[model samples]
Target: MLRHQMTIVSETLMPADTAPSAAAVRSRVTVPLRFPDGYTATAEVLTFHGLADGKEHLLLALGAWEQALLDPEKLDPALPDAGPLVRLHSECLTGDVFGSQRCDCGPQLREAVEKISATGGFLLYLRQEGRGIGLYSKLDAYALQDTGLDTYEANVALGHGEDERDYTAAAQMLGALGATTVRLLTNNPDKAAQLTALGIGVTEQVPTEVHLSPANHAYLAAKRDHTAHTLDLAQPAVPSHDEMLARVDALIPRLRERAEETERIRRIPESTMEDLREAGVFRVLSPKAVGGFGMGVETYVEVVRRLGRGCPSTAWTVGHLIEHVWMLARWPRKVQDEVFADGAEPLAAATGAPVGQATKVPGGYSISGRWTFASGVMHSEWVLLAVQHGDVRLQCLVPISDVELLDVWHTAGLRGTGSNDVRAEELFVPAYRTLDWALLGAADNPGSRIHPDPIIHTPMATLLNLVAPAAALGAAEHAVEMFRERVLVRRVKNTLEDRQADSPLAQARFSHAYGLVATARLQWEEAIRVVTASYQRRPMTMTDHERAAYRLSLGLSGTASAEAVRVIMAGSGGSAHRLSNPLQRIQRDVDVLLNHPTLTLDPILEQAGRGLLGLGITVPSF
Candidate 1:
């Protein structure tokens, strides 16, 4: 059972000029506090004015019993007169109200409230958002933190102190609340010392439990190391996939820097490739038994999306190479052993078009043809060539030594992919090196029997086709970001408006484009989730309708991305057409990407319509 009663005794609004002093009492209200955890207490909510920022603030004095109106002249006889628990919690709208995982503020606040409810104490909810920098500036600091700055550093970058909060208002509130001596609930010793200096006796300091989480682990660590907060920094939690994404995100700057060089040379720069390899970009989709991460398809796509945000070309190449590892796992055990023998990732490039001729032999097939648009061939050790042996289509794995590279990729966009032609002249691939296209499509491959991982049994066509649109989504998102930055400061050359950001048209365009991009991303993610979920189920199977719908959703995502880029380019003005402008390049890349056979919107929609109508699928593989 809980017992509490709350009522407002008075309400008043003071003018800025007539605001009460920091120690001046304004009004008092009784607040019946009840937590979800069933802890209940009655608190006298005192309002004060003329704080550090000259704003009204609040202090809640809670007790196990009801207290009289707050007065500085006398202490509540029912409340403890000596030591009492105190919490000086700053206000955090994001963490407290909205439950943002970016910080431990909400959890700390709740913990403080719960403790104060169980034991008699005060919880001074300071009106300091973002460490006394205010709400908007705090949000600005968050943007800086996203760019690889620690919380304190971000505040410093925004021209604020590491600790901008002053304890004067809190001390005054405590004095008025009749808290002469206190047992502070805080991790910072400075808080206790400051309160003690302000004439309050800190008899004891109770350390708050560290609310450790992936989002705020680094933040907590920063407080422990730099701010001298008492936190055990040792034995940090294991990194999650989100942390892996953060690691990839940290490499975006380098990838962006090398984008032009990659395009100029029609290949990913050696340094950039090495960095990506070291980052485990190529091993994301590989089997764990063979020293691979064996991440789910959704996570793999997300990684590719992040990489694409930095450089779509690099993202495309990396996605293919990583996905090829998954495909290789569908081959025979002998082939898997040979491919992963050294435990080093063998970068592989693949082409799905069965343009090559394969002559059936006793042990294998003799393949001869030129495969066009083979991305990442420049750096790959092996090439998965799609060849036709009689009436059956086969994916034959051949070493780079068996193929001749032709520098034939000349494109307006994605030029960095180095998707050139590879010619194989009578290259004899052993039986173990080839996988039947039908078996792979049905998720019934030789490798699935040996390696019991359900992901190995995923439908290959849908998995491979999904990567291109993921890269396109990244590029589209980048275009939106570029446009947002440009429009904020850019102005109409002769117009009265000072900035494009102030223009209604610019605002509408940005909003529409952002909506399109966000919707596209959601569509892509949901599609990947469905596929990965199916893979997790043993003996994964996809109906014709399911397969067609997946392809259709991917195509829609690609088209949506292209539409978003188009909208941004249209609103960006003439400067966006320049070669140096990334918008134009992104636009071109999306255009070329949408033209991909699997990602083509019209055909995919038609196939989906056919599948839904119970007709034959135009593209049976997908």
Candidate 2:
């Protein structure tokens, strides 16, 4: 279904003789309507005079619908002051009366009545049977439908327009009832569009529940594909892309205020973690099967980048935590069920480079190793450790209680990451909880088959490339903003200029800084393009060339973004480096981000050079 945040259509002229007034309302009679499902309501059935379509259209006002009418001066209600909820339901006899399962019309009508009754509104039952093709033609169309033609195509085959129902009567009925504005309950855009076009003020278009059935799956699918209905037939629905970003953007101020405390304590505060949870930051990339948004890597990158502007440490920790949800999705189905049982959204932190050892046991393996730099481990309930079991390298999922933390995370930057070392001494890991490290590149892995989202097939190398760079880019962007602000106030001590903003050097530095930030974002977008394009086509394991492309583009994004921060730091006055200033923290955080094993310059450069020269890549994880 099509959703617009707000759609305001200009009111137009109607036939002067038939325009709504006291005469538009002909009569009203009280009636009690009940359904076989035990739902009951008292409705005031009303007849209208001079409607465009002379057919006997009836309007049933339920609940406090009469009390909701305004004084004709108020066009819209604000916030909690909601306008009447209305439904323009065209006549459907087969489904609504005979309980046919071939279409969702019956359930939709039931839902609309209940919802409208609860919110106080009128149900305008227009006599446009079979989408205005009449009952006989509708039955003929149904015959065509039995031959595999969809709802719309069957109508066309029967020599009728696809959908002939019009909403002129609906708008007229609302006008007669003094409901100029309404919260429309519908999944059909046509109702909203026609009503708007006919001078009805639609304050909001609220979608009705999707009444799907195994018998009518194809019918719903046709309606969704052909007419663009808002139906998530594949998986559970997630918020729209813009809505998700808005949720993250809304948290920026809070994150910025807490950045100091986060770094001072060397970990994210509990309150801050709750804020992230409320913002849905940690589930941005988790599997939809387990109640996650199941978003793609591109969305994940953009989310990480935006989060960094609030606080680099918070963004870094949250970014890893979000990616771990994606990592957990790649595990076997049994492990996924165990971890996500009882509606628990698991927060996991993983470390793989400093490999551990796993000895094969009866049903699993005994793993032992000290993995360093487990970012966000302090908040995580599970730790994914990379271990060598015999000749095969495996990723073992262990509970946080199975490990001992070594507080050795003192660093030059990103101090809030709390990337301490975790030692797991001779701990038993079930076979179901372990996956072969080599399968990280497989497109048809266990998770891919289990989760409908294709991002579950993303390679670890590709994710590693995107994760840190996204946060680095966000910090660099903040650096440029802070530098621009400082350039306005800082005056040259020895020079005659009143402010540094008047100096040619300041202008040059700001211009260069802005250009570097733009370049870094463009570079990062290239890696995103590569990752998103492949996922759309089909999830495929990245070839060496693809990894090299990602390595160069994303690696350069981090490097370029770091240079942007460096330029900002150099141009910013001495006072800018103080602990109180966020600019210095941003620089230090980005510096440590560049030192990540994946973002390090030497391997990235070598991988790019090899790909350019048509040589094999030496670094498999590049």
How far is 429's C-alpha from truth in model 2 (Å)?
Answer: 1.5
Best by TM-score: 2
Q: Candidate 1: how large is its RMSD?
A: 16.9
Candidate 2 lDDT: 0.80
**Clash totals in order:** 0, 2
Q: Score every model by TM-score.
A: 0.61, 0.64
Tens-place lDDT digits, model 2, residues 1-622: 0001111111233434434332266788999988866799889898977777788999998877755543212432353335588888888899889878788888888888888777678888889989899999999988998898998999999889999987777777777655667778888888888777666667788988877644567788888999987777663468777888998898888888988888998999897887777667777888877767888776788889999998889889998888887888887889888887633258888998599999989999998888999998999989999999778988989989889989999988889989999998889998888899888546767888798876787666667667788999999988888787777987779888898889998899899989999999998898888777666665455656766787788889999999999888888878778999898899899999999876788878887889867798876666
RMSD of each: 16.9, 15.2
Residue pairs of candidate 2 with colliding backbone atoms: 1-229, 1-230
* Model 2: lDDT of residue 480: 84
The lDDT of each candidate is 0.79, 0.80
